[model samples]
Every structure is written in structure tokens, then in C-alpha cells.
Target: MSKILDKLKVVELTTFVAAPTTGRMLADWGADVVKVEPLEGDFFRGYGKGLNVPADTGENPLFDMYNSGKKSLALNLKTEEGMAVLHDLLKDADVFITNNRTKALKKMGIDYDSLKQKHPRLIYATITGFGDKGPLADAPGFDTVAFWGSSGALVDLSIETGNSYPLNTPAAVGDVASGTNLFGAIMAALYARELNGKGDKVTVSLYGSAVWSMSFMNVIAQEKYGYKYPKKRYEVNPTAAPYRTKDNEWIMLTILDHDRYFPSLCEIIGRPELSRDPKFIDKIALLNMDNRKELMQILEDAFNKKDAHEWHLLLTQKDIVHDILKHFKDISTSEQAMANNYMSEFAFPNGQKAMLAKPSLQSDNLGEIENFRGPYLGEQSISVLDRLSYSKAKIEELLSKGIIKQ
Candidate 1:
């Protein structure tokens, strides 16, 4: 089957997770994505080393996860020649995605307004730490600082976890979410372009994404009957929380239909009598903080009586909506992940195989996701320049002048 984005072309000037994530999704749909990086390479190409990843191979799996299958064009963007080369490349491209700050983008003359004037039909998507028009517009925003720290997600999450010390997020949650949003915006802009014969300036921010993710709680906290996030013991829906098992494994339940699921949950935990108890007779009664705390204690004690695996079987038999809190490695080995093509076996240059996630979307016409390795620095520099109609001698001269790298 032909790929959905086979006719599309993208120019990706991005680093780390967010913008690259958008490019990866485009590539997954078969867009010819050219990743423009500095001569030294994207900073993320060396980020894996900081995590103590073994240096035995040229592979940077972390980088590859979001960049695989994209062509690399390493050039010195600070140089006028390099900027001209980028302009040439963009003249015929369908999309341009970047995560550089407003000042950097303006300095490079690649801001949305500038690009839109130059190429009215080109989709220009920009990702920032904060929205582009704020006092902190040019501030450096990594996902950690902008998304978690500045967005109050760290504080809000710590409130639930009962940790006073700000907690670290799993990893790149904000960046990835922001990128996914950008992808949707770009798609929408593409659809609009089809009708209007002109593209759009799409922008998304890590702070904005983080806020959107937790807007419900924030909304409630500002309302008339405002309330802060409750502690686990005070959670109104006691069944919809995590409980520790005999094996010390945590199992999370999402029994959202409190009235219908509460009785069954109590029965499955061997505390059936609690279901008929007066204080816990209905969802309204359960909303009482004191009553909820007592019920949470009861559930916690009952959960501690069985191992997580044993509870999993019993819960499955009861048709309960619950899951064992698994580590990352456990998720990598999940049967559901494999069955749904959520993960694919990625073979690295070092002859090692690791299962990496396929792009998030799934479609019948989309073939099996390939595990193409990410390009080395400037891996396609010469070819890209050649395709842009640069002469061989000019390419050599540019390389010698440090304007481009291969």
C-alpha cells in the first residue's frame, strides 16, 4: 500500500523530543523529512551518553526513537551560505517544523511571518518553551523547566504523591505531548491549505500543553466550591487509586462508574460487607472525607493480602478496570504493546535489537513500521545539497569553508 504522506516533504529544524516527535510522525506517514542540524550534530545526539548509556556503539537509541528514517542535513545556520541553502530547500517543501526560541528564529529570518511571506503555501510549525508572544518569549525552555517546573505540574503532581520535594516526571512527557499537539495542528493546517491554497503558522508550547493536560484540576481549584487536590487517603473515589499488594507492587484502578463498580470491587477484595455499610452506601456518602479515608484504609489492607499478579487474574475475572503499575522494561515486554504494533524491533548498528514504539497512529493502509536507523551527522548533506542543484565544486567549496558538513 502507498503511504499516506508519500508525496509530502518536510524540513525539520529541531532538537530533543518535541519538534522531532512531530517530524517522526510525519516520516512515519512516509513524508521525506530532512532534519537540518548544526555541523556538530543535534545536541541530543550526545544526550544519551549523559544517561550513562554505553559508548560501545555509534547508535543513540534515544535520538533515533524520534529521528529515525529522516535525512540529516548538517549546516552552519549562522552562516549566510547555510541560510541560503535552507531557503533553497524550503522553497519546495510542504512543511517546516522548528523548536527554536522566538529570538533565534527571528535572528535566522525563519519566523512564521517571514516564512509565510516567502512561501505562502508552506506549513510553518513552531514549538516553543512558552507561547511566542510573552515576556519569556525568548527564554530558554526545556520540557523540565517550562512544562513541569513553570506550569505548576510539579507542584500539582507532588500534592497527589504527597511529596513536598518537587518530583521528576517520567521523561519528556511535556515535550512529547506538545509535539503531538503540533502534529495535529500541522495536519489541520494542511487540510486548510487544501481548501484555501495557503498554509498557516502553527505554534505550540510546552507550558501550554502541560497546562492543558491538568486543566481540570486547575479549573476546580479556581471555582466557587474550589478545592485543592486531595491526598490519597482523602480521594473521594477510593476504588480509583493505587494500592500496594503483598509483593510490594502497586496496582491502579480506574473504576470510574463509582455507583456500579464499588460493590463489585468490594466483593472482589473479599470485603463484600463494606458495600452495604451505611456510610458507604452511595457515591454521595463516599464523598465525605472521613468516610473516604476509612474506606481507603480498608482497601489498602485488603490489597496487601494478595500479590499483584494474583490480583491481576482475580480482577480480570471480575472484569475490573485496573492495571499493575509496571516499570518501563515491563511495558517493553507487554503482549498488548506487541499485538497492537505499538512496539517494533529496532536493530542497531551494533547488532543489538531493542523494541521501540512505532508512531502513535495506526491505519489499515499503513504498512508495518520500518526500523530505519537515524542518520549520522551530515549523513545526507551532500545528497541534499546536490538535490537542491548545488554544483559539485560549490559543494566542495562549501564543505571546505565549514558552511556545510558531511
Candidate 2:
């Protein structure tokens, strides 16, 4: 059977991660995604440092990771001719996905209201920090500010605490979340349009998307606990926090199988007292303690007798739930990840053997796609213009006028 989005045509007009992410997902599923970039190209092209080689032209691993399986056409939207090219591209586009604001869009007549009039069946989707019409809408919707910090996630994760914690992973939380949710919205709208024979606008905000990802905590605080989480960091579960192993390595322990693992853990650690003491035994009572410091210290001391590897092995032998702190390299080389087909190796045009993490979904027939060395600035402009029925003469004229990047 054809892939899901075989008939879908996506005009991706936004830059950076979140917006491009939506288009990338669609393109992965076999949609005809045409990335409309600025003359300077997407800034993400410079996001990566030293390439596989010292002076490789395709140095942007970030760009390649996000924009694979899509064609790019560079155009200067500030130019009237470039804006004209956009409207032409929109003629039969099934969906328009963007993170750029309405004012910028209105100048190019790419606004939802404007496009909907021209092609009422076109699905218009947007991603922003706030709603398009809101006061904070104009704020740059970055993953750090909008997704993590503003969404109450940073505070919940306690990265906001003055007391030091490890730095966050270098991933775009908001962008990926926004992309995921926006993809869902676009697909749902497309499905709905089949029956209604009409398209609709789908909107997602960085702040709102971040909050939705935290629905579990929201429910627990509002309904179950009937109390607001403290503005300051509140330890949700004191016993489950990070602990140190005997060899001076950090291990996060959550003895939630307290009824089960508690006894085994005690036996392994030579701390039968903690297992036997009723005052410090049960979770609720332990939580209610006036002096948890003594108990915590005891547990920490007991844990420090062995290295992380020894503890991991000993705990697993007893069916305890625990894990080691895995770095990016660890996960990359992990046997489990390899077994699950999560990573694939490919040879780039430069003849470098690189490993790429697979997309969230998998298919037996889906093309194995690791060699897409992201486009040069407007690399496919002439080819893309040719598809739009522009003659070679016209394309050269446009390129020579500095109206589009090549």
C-alpha cells in the first residue's frame, strides 16, 4: 500500500526546529514537502560545529537531521517576486504549516484567513509561544523559554532550584513536542476534511504544548492533592531522589516496590535495621518523619559500599526496579537500542560512516534514509522552480536578480 501521506502536499514556510519538524514528519510519511527557506537558508544549517571532516560543506548535522526527505527552495520573501512565488506554490498545497507570525505572513498573503479564501480546503496550522492573537504571541518561542521554563516543566524538574542539579539534555523539548502535537492536529484535520469537504486551521503554542505534556502532574496537584505545588522546589517523593553509590557514582533510586524491593535492598546493603524499623518502614510514615536526614544518611551510607555496576547487578538479581545513568554515547551504543533498530549506519556523500537515530515510527517498507546531506542554501531552487513550470530562462532571471538563493 502507499504510505499514509502519499497524496498530501506540504508547504513548509517556517524555520528552526518546531516548524520544520512538522514538515519533516509529513515528508517522512511520503508527503511532498517543499521547504520554503529564506535567501540565507535556515539558521539551523549553522547549528552544528566541526563536521565529519574539517572543511565539509554539509556541516549542519542539525539541519540534515531535521530536514531530511524533503526538498528545499530558497526565496527572499521580502521581495514581491518571491512572495508571488509562494502564492503560486500554495495553489494546490494540502496544508500550510508555519511558526512565523501573522504580520510576516500577511505581507506575503500566507495568513490562514487569506489562504483559506484562496483555497478553502487548505489546512492552515500554526505553532507559537502563545496564541496568534495574544499579547505574548510575538515573543520568540524557543524550547528553553517557552517549552521548558514557561510550561512549569523547569520548576517541576527542579532545574529552577538554586541548589545545583545536572544540566538538561541538549534537546529541543518544545520544538519536538510542538512538532508531534502539530503533526497530530494536521492529520486529524485532514481526516475530518474527508467528510466535511472543508479544511480547518490547527494551532499549537509552545507554552500550551509544554503544559499539555505535563498533564499527569497537573491532575495530581489539582484533583488528588487539592493543593498548589510550591513556587519553590518541592520534593515530590523524598525517598526516590538521587543517591550516591559506594564507588562515588550517582544512582537515582526509587524503591517504589517498597513492599517488595525494600527487604531485598536491605539484605543486599547490610541494613536490616531500616527494613525492620516500623517508624522508618512504611512510605507514608517515612514521609511524615520530622527527621528524614538521619534515615537518608543511613541509606546513603549503606548504598556507598558498592559501585554502580555492583548495585545494578545485585538489584537486578532480586527483580528490583533500577537503572544506571546513561550518557548519550551509552544510549547510542547500547545493545538494547541496536536490537530495537533504533539506530542505523549510513555512508554520506563525503564517505563518512555516520549513525542516525531512527524516527519514532517504523515500517518494513519505508526507505532507509540516512544519506540526505541537507540541501545547500537553496540547493534545489532551479529544480523546484522547474516543477512549478518556471522555464530555465525565467529561473536564471530570478536567480540573477538576487530574488532567490541558489
Largest lDDT belongs to which candidate? 1
Candidate 1: list runs displaced more than 4 Å. 55-57, 159-163, 230-236
Residues 162-261 of candidate 1 have per-residue lDDT tens digits of 3466666667888889999999999999999999999888999998997898787778777586666544445656878889999999999878777787
Q: Write the per-residue lDDT of candidate 2 for residues 192-283, one digit (tens) a residue.
A: 99999999999998888877887777777775576455432223443565667877776777778677777777787777777777756777
Backbone atom clashes (below 3 Å) for every candidate? 0, 1
Candidate 1 residue 317 Cα shift, in angstroms, is 2.0
For all predicted structures, in order, the TM-scores are 0.95, 0.87
Off by over 4 Å in 2: 50-56, 159-171, 218-239, 289-291, 363-371
| CA lDDT, candidate 1, residue 85 | 95
Question: Poorest 10 consecutive residues of model 1 by lDDT?
Answer: 156-165
